[model samples]
Target: MRFTRLAGLSGIGFVLLLLGGNLALVSAGFPTPSDAVGFDEVARLHADASDALRLTSALLPTAWLLATIFAAGVFAALWRHDRIRGDGWALVGLAGILMQCVAFAGVGAARLAVATTATHDPGTASHDLGAVAGLWGLHNALFGFNQIFLATALLGLSVSGRRAGLVGRWHAAVGLLGAALLFLAATTSPYGADGVNPLALFGLVGWLLWLVWIVGYSVVLIRGVEEEVPSALATP
Candidate 1:
């Protein structure tokens, strides 16, 4: 009898998590200020702070692992909604995300502390340079790949799952696009030496697309779930 409508309820969580996290990141990201004539005052301070800064910087990807979890969780829910067959796949995806978060938390934290200890402060010239450098590696790229894979799986689930149907398809598509963009984020502009990383903007935009997709789908799915179809025999 507990015919709870998932359309309105849990789906909204998906939207908020994606959107809220993105907004927080954007607002928090002020860029590494570079305007130090001489390292007189800030030099020692920056060097002193390197350890702490490094730890925090390293932990960023770990922080985003939550988003990865959220992404996997969202996709898992989609599996349920779509009535897809791969509950096991969903579980594996979830495990990858959870493990990724837990494993990276401490590791990234240590790195961040170092970065924090290195960079004096954002106001200083060499704000997050070293920290940014640490992120340019295979691990970041691999993690980014995981995000894209999750998105694609969800989109595929949406298309094939009968429960969600057309509405679900659209939802999956948007979410997938968002996840795809996440890959480019690590290598984009700031992370890359090229100065302009398209993936950077695309990643954010893609993630935002996911937020919008979930919100829009929540409304539609709720309505669909609540609707009572009147068959031909019941027509008065």
Candidate 2:
């Protein structure tokens, strides 16, 4: 199969892996960043769910790899259009996707550390609440900031793809809307770190939109259909 086709498949794989990881996390009763519980509670939860946490951690690397490939495929598809030649929006989108991979690596590491620390010695982990809390904070911070990269990817690709006539106007609109919400969430993330807050809602809604947009985008890529560019826009 062509690399392009493989990349399209990888996009769906990425989504599936992400969904599986979330399911594992939910099944394990993992706390969200917005959970207002004390560090001791956090440690206990981690200790109880160590296996599930580890499993989630294991899924992340493969998901990030697939996400990177999908971004490259998007860039390849968009960069060929004359409208985006000098703007390099597709390249920016690719960079956003790559940066997310790097940022999420930190998230996975923090989660794994919590799982390891909590499971090894529950008493000791309780005693070292500060360390565990720090790790959890790190995880939350990374998770919050990662939305910025997602927003960047959405903005770059949506604008360029729309200009290139590679995606429908509604698709581009969804991307733009998602970008705005995610960016808002990133900006307000600090306020939401400790517990449930209004700021978290922005991220939640944006993430849902992101899932939708990515699935739609992936289907479009798999179809490999490029609408005709207008004569005026097609001119070099």
Candidate 3:
């Protein structure tokens, strides 16, 4: 199959993974770190013995793996389209995505450790709870850094795609807007501090729109691949 089709399918799958993870967390009543005052509370909410909580913890790492695949597919599509033109942005975007994925995996691992501690050791739960909170803070900090790299990847793709005529100016513009908003959010996130920012919430809105754009972009690429098939098949 064409790289475009692969990218489209991967993008769809990535979105599904995110949605599924969020749903699982919500079903388990998992509290956001902001809501939980300390490690003990974090453990109480997220590291519970309930099956739903375990599912929620598992979904986070699984989602990161899916994101890595999605990023790889996007990188392949971008490189296929722009490499002949000597555009380096595709590689830049790929590097940024890889960084984001690795950092996210770290966060997932930390979260999983906290969950494991909470599940297996009731005797040490109180004593180790503070350490788990520190881990949670580290995870949040990692997430904030991940968003910065994610924004970089998005911006790189937007500029490169527009220059290569792979996508329209307006489409690229929307991507730029989304990336800018995310960058702002990343900068204001305070390196994973617990308190919230209104700008970060606004950035979340942009992120939502940005996700919609990705889905639409993937559909366009998939259709382009469909259009190419007949011509390739008809060639002698």
Candidate 4:
């Protein structure tokens, strides 16, 4: 039997495990955007929010780095082995993860900058969160695109063995669809203060599915994987 991917799978597990840390950062002292237009009122909240974001900033980088390294393991397993099917999926997933790193850092910093710029004057309330809003919208917009890559990657993996080429097509198609919606959210319509957007939630769910699939499939693949004749790799 051909060897599956043990090390790569384990790497994915480790990568996903970092999400717990990220969650903790987000929860530390998150701030709520308020409708109030008073600088003084917003300053308190903004400072509180900034403190939380600082923690989050630290968390996201660590999470992203861990995930990237872990994903590299996946690449080694799927790509090095010329497991064309899984490798394609992994590439797509990697794109999303990388984009997330940018989005998280840019947006987090932007929000923090805005919060810092705030003054205690109530008159400046209207402009107080300018930086915050800029980053908030930009980050969410990127997230919209970023999440789709992950979904496409996962979907690709699920159906890779059956039809590598076909799966690639699906990966591109679904990825495009997810990214498109995100683009729309970022540019045209956008997800404003209109309660939670269902599309955003769906994106998250799709990602979770991919993560779960990867972790589960990884276990099965790892158990069965073994070193084999190098010639076998050249067969198909």
Candidates' C-alpha lDDT: 0.44, 0.79, 0.65, 0.47
lDDT of 1: 0.44
**Where in model 2 is the C-alpha error above 4 Å?**
123-127, 193-197, 226-236
Cα lDDT over the full model 2: 0.79
| Model 2: residue 52 alpha-carbon error in angstroms | 1.0
TM-score of candidate 4 relative to the true fold: 0.59
TM-score of each: 0.48, 0.91, 0.80, 0.59
- Candidate 1 per-residue C-alpha lDDT over 1-236 given as tens digits, one digit per residue, 9 for 90 to 100: 21223534455664554455434433543222211122233334435555444444544553454445344444444465434454454454445345544544544454344344445443344545444434323323443344454444444433433243424445556655665665456344345433334455575576567557645544544444334222211122
Q: Residue 105 CA error for candidate 4 (Å)? A: 3.4
User: How do the residues 1-236 of candidate 4 rate in per-residue lDDT, one tens digit apiece?
Assistant: 33345344544654565466446544654332212133344445556555665555566555666556544544444454444644465566556555555665565665566556643432255564554455445544554444444544444433332232212333334444544444433333245443233455445444444555445435534544334223322123
**Model 4 per-residue lDDT at 61:** 59
- Residue-by-residue lDDT tens digits, candidate 2, 137-207: 88888988999999999999888878887777788889999999999988888776354444777787887
In order, how many clashes per candidate? 32, 0, 0, 1
| Of 2 and 3, the candidate ranking higher by TM-score | 2
lDDT of 3 at 26: 67
Deviation in Å, model 4, residue 235 alpha carbon:
21
